[model samples]
Target: MKQPLIIIIRSINFSRVNKERNKRDIERNKRSKMVSSASSSEAKIISQCFVKPKTVSETSKDPYNLSPMDHVMLSFQYIQKGLLFLKPSDGAIKPQDFMETLLQKLKDSLATALVHFYLLSGRLSTSVTDDASSYSVFVDCNNSSGAGFIHAKSDLSVGDIVGSKYVPLVVQSFFDHHNEVKAKVTELVDGVFVGLSMNHSIGDGVSFWHFFNSLSEIFSSQETIDNNIKLFCLKNPPILRQVSTGSVYSLPFSESPKSNPQFQTQVLQERMLHFSSEAVRSLKSKANQESGTTTMISSLQSLTAFIWRSITRARKLQSDQETTCRFVADSRPRMVPPLPMNYFGVYISLVKTTAKVGNLLENEFGWAASKLHHVVVEHTGEKICSEMKRRFNPPCALPSETFYDPTIVHMGNSPRYDNYGCQFGMGKAVAVRSGNNDKYDGKVSAYPGREGGGSIDLEVCLLPEFMEALESDQEFMSPVSPSSG
Candidate 1:
């Protein structure tokens, strides 16, 4: 007989009475552990990421005024260094030099006219000035106390990962309700942190990458960096002006009364997992065979099934209830004639799947997983896409009083960044950590790498019981394949 795989799911929703008690118990334990851990070792805590711009010469201003699209392009100049360690011997690669190099590379490699527009858009406001200001570059770094390194903050360590709080103006609405959300990023003793925020209103991940590629090239060489990356001044540059009356770009919350915010602010919870490229492939294969779907679809299905099961177990939900999971997809590819790969604009669509509480806890795991795959497929069809397009472009809204509550959110990291060598003379880091958005019940980001044959670095957040169950499960904690390192 084959050994069955085990997964732990801790549910977040509990009867109101039990929720507070559970949260208290978790918090108490966390505080105790933190005290004990801090007393035992030298560690540091750090703030979220923040970026400082290079002061430009006012006299050298280009003839063309900056557009919002230019600001979106400029925002893409930020990069995430997965794992970077200091090499004290490399005298030339100081932090400032690395940043300047990166800026120059972007100017040389990508000359799209929109870069000018993005830069212009960003200049209008330091924070939440315009729609193009929604793009954000989140810099994640580790906190260390070894040797010459100083302490970061109260909650971080030599290898702990933390990032900028949110995606620029995209989360401005959250700040409007709570001032803490707008707090400035502070200095850290042990870790390097910085984030560039742009308007997600202007671009998606693909466009961000395009702008990053240009920046990377310039960062790699000063002399080779080109001045022509500024495209807005050129004739016939693409335009992404806001549609004044289009129903698609309107916010559903616009007409609704503001409700009290429920979550905390700027606080980040970090977690990391390493899966060998080969092991990820094997699991993907197994998952594909089990669900008969594409890699992403299968992975999403299995993971969702696993999460729902684990959460239900922790919640001890009685049979016959229901729950939901939501995933975001970039829709730039589906637009008419397809949007530019480097078009700096916000264009995303969502796919949601809901299952009965009982269906998740059914006897067979594979069966439950298959059902999830089917549901996701059904939810991502033409009608759904068309409806989403219509909603974003012109005019539509969910009914009043209806809230889009998501228990889990998932995103895939762009794999291309790996080739850029995020290290600036520092040895490559052993692990990279991306923090979470507290706005959701839980979040997961998937990153791809070449070594160990291609695996993903997963950042996850869950209730204590759910986290405990997930880490304790052999199927999840164990190496998927013998070669997985």
Candidate 2:
């Protein structure tokens, strides 16, 4: 009887062990299946795709006339380009999520944005009235055409483009809009690049930023289903005021059309130079001290002065040679009655200051600052309005003589745009750039620094030789943070 009982106990123990092993095996198989499923989902990569408006509006087809200012800008049929924003991959958000949900969200938001910016949905056309001599170009807002939206995957990483020595031409290619305002999204290995290519005739930098801000605002408010997207609508929408016949500046338009001048085919190199708040403050103080003036110079003025002087010196131009610094100042506040902040048009005037290379390089920093300040101050409301009244006209173009010259440095964009704040659910852009605008030698684009706090990023382009000289200048390089390059 004792032997039989011991055998029974052993049998019971064996059965219990068998049960536990079976349970463990089931769980292991379940986990393996889950892991395999996740791997398969993650492996799904969207190599290329196109996004179009989910819904089209009837008004999109309505014919819209270009503002006089718009006509004036048409002469520059080239693309006004910029990196809309770029954010690194969020660890919490998987690549699959980006490929699936994020892309759809972007499309939906963009479709909504186009509803308000209807002009972008249309194509350009020219119409001639009974007077054969007069011809007008207008945006055919009839929603027959849609803004371009492209999604592409690239092996290149974000670091390979941003903060690199040159603007990535491959990345810029993503913004090819065929002369229309278009947006693109390209996925890199570790991050994403968003870019915009708008026709220069459509708007200026401020208008461009406003449109982008509106798009971002709509995109971020997605959680609130009932949220209304607001845009500029006025009882008396601002008109492109006519120019008086007696204008100080000549009408830039030509009766005979001419091909756009192509600059030297030599490749231009772009370099991004960073100035921290501390560095900017030091430069400003140095300028004030050197000028021995009680009046304080602004950060923009000080930095512009320093960069102008540095470029002049780096180029090693003749002492008697003349160098011009040209930048567009916003004319909104300078209008008789300040234009509404939402006025959707180009309200800017070109302010050009010229100096002998030797005098500019030899003068105290304050002198250069003073020169910039004077040009800015002189463009008061009365002055800008007076100038606009004089030169404003329809079917006008920029003067042929106004072609870009290596001796002239053109400043584009501004630090005040707050580009770093242009976040789209993903974190803020690690870096922002003015895309192909940097293709031209002697072109400089400025953006607020990533760290905020009054820092500035100067995207400077020059001939390879001048860039080499500027990069090596100890005094010029002193203000540039090593991490920025």
Candidate 3:
């Protein structure tokens, strides 16, 4: 038996829901195109369409400019997430009937949800400065095409996917994308797969989950409060534009840099390892006690340090070679005055901590963790704003080390997202999966364990050899909650 793997997929979808049988089919065709599948067993897009908001808002009609933070992440791949659910209990709803109900509910609710998240339905535009030194990006709200929604089915069961040792290729290139925000629902033999994907530039994980939750909330509410628009008071309406002041402002990209060929060609193995709350606490306590500090090191910092050492050893890098760890910190609270929770789009600061592989491997776990803690602390709102002015006066091209460098390890996503809360009136999701949108070697996406209680699942991507070595490392493996696979 293998331990249940819960993937932290970062994905999104929306569209109009009209009940005219023939016209719905015709309109679906006119609004979106059908995608072809490679094989009979693989998932196929039966229908596709762009989803727009039900109510038009004059406030959202203007072209919305993306903030500098958004520009900084324009080159990154889209965030893709998926949730899995067993069919409804009683098996009363036939597959076709259940799917039809789900499809309509999602579409109708997504349209309502889009009223609040207008940017999802819009297109991204970029323009170069007259000096030809830089460019700016914005969302063309007026020419909206709506978010992408696709209905697909496959023969794969939960076991066929989660039971595999590695991510199957079929799940990697499952859907074709056209809109900035894309979504898919694939009905498996034993369960349903709901996926959401969005351009990284549009938002970070915070915004992504918020929009997704809103859609799910709307969809689920249809059973009772179906038409009570006033009842769906947005807890925190999203503020899409940058609201905080900065010392200086400039875009991060010299140009929207093309996708890295290295990332595309790289062969990586992904493994999701679970660490219980107790293990994390023990790791933290031991790290702090060893460092002779009581309060400075956090659970995440300690775990990160532990993994850093483990992976460096696994890689067998030379003592003198540099090993860099880069992770994101929320910039909203770091903003000069601190933006509220509803602040949307990209507002994140990437912090990097580097050390010689030998130094990291030889040092006590506390030493490496202290470096990560200090680097993250130094990345204050003031420093973040100042970095903007310094990074691109004349537009400095992004260094290869920023992303494609082999010596780099990037830790992303948080374990706090309400991933399991995406219930669509079918009770709750039994599992979660991350799609292969921007996967690469040395990437770790963290998510809250499905069983909760401070448990965390790190979906780590490494070369096949690296993964094997990592799994065998006693120091790292000891803390991992065992799985059957």
Q: Tell me the tens digit of each residue's lDDT in model 1 across 1-485.
A: 00000000001111122335434434644432222222211112222222222333232132222233222233222222223222233556664465344333332222231233323222222212245423222111111110011112222222222222112111111111111111111112233221222223234555444443343333344444355533223322334433322211222222235885443332223344555665555555665665543444454455445545565565555676666655556555556556654554555556566667676566445555666566555644465557744543433333322333334334344443453343322244333432122223355555554352455555554455555666677756675322111
**Per-residue lDDT of 138-242 in model 2, one digit per residue for the tens?**
566542446666665544445555644555444444454245455666655555656666666666777677767776676677777553534323222323333
Q: RMSD, each candidate, Å?
A: 13.1, 17.3, 9.2
Model 2 misplaced regions, further than 4 Å = 1-62, 77-94, 227-263, 292-294, 399-401
Which residue pairs in model 2 clash with each other?
Answer: 60-141, 60-142, 60-143, 61-142, 61-143, 334-381
Q: Which of the two candidates, 1 or 3, achieves a greater TM-score against the reference? A: 3
- What would the per-residue lDDT of candidate 3 be over residues 1-485, giving only the tens digit for each residue? 00001112111111211225324333332322222222434566677777777877886776566655565566666787877777765877776687788788888877778888877877777656678766566676677667777777665566555555554444653443432467777766567778888787788888888887887877776767736564355666777663332323345345445884552456567767878888988988888877754458888888878877888888889999999988878788888799876777777778889999988988788888888888877888899888876864533335334576778788888887888888887677766677666677788888877777777778888876788788889989999984322
Ranking by TM-score: 3, 2, 1
In order of appearance, the predictions have TM-scores of: 0.57, 0.79, 0.84
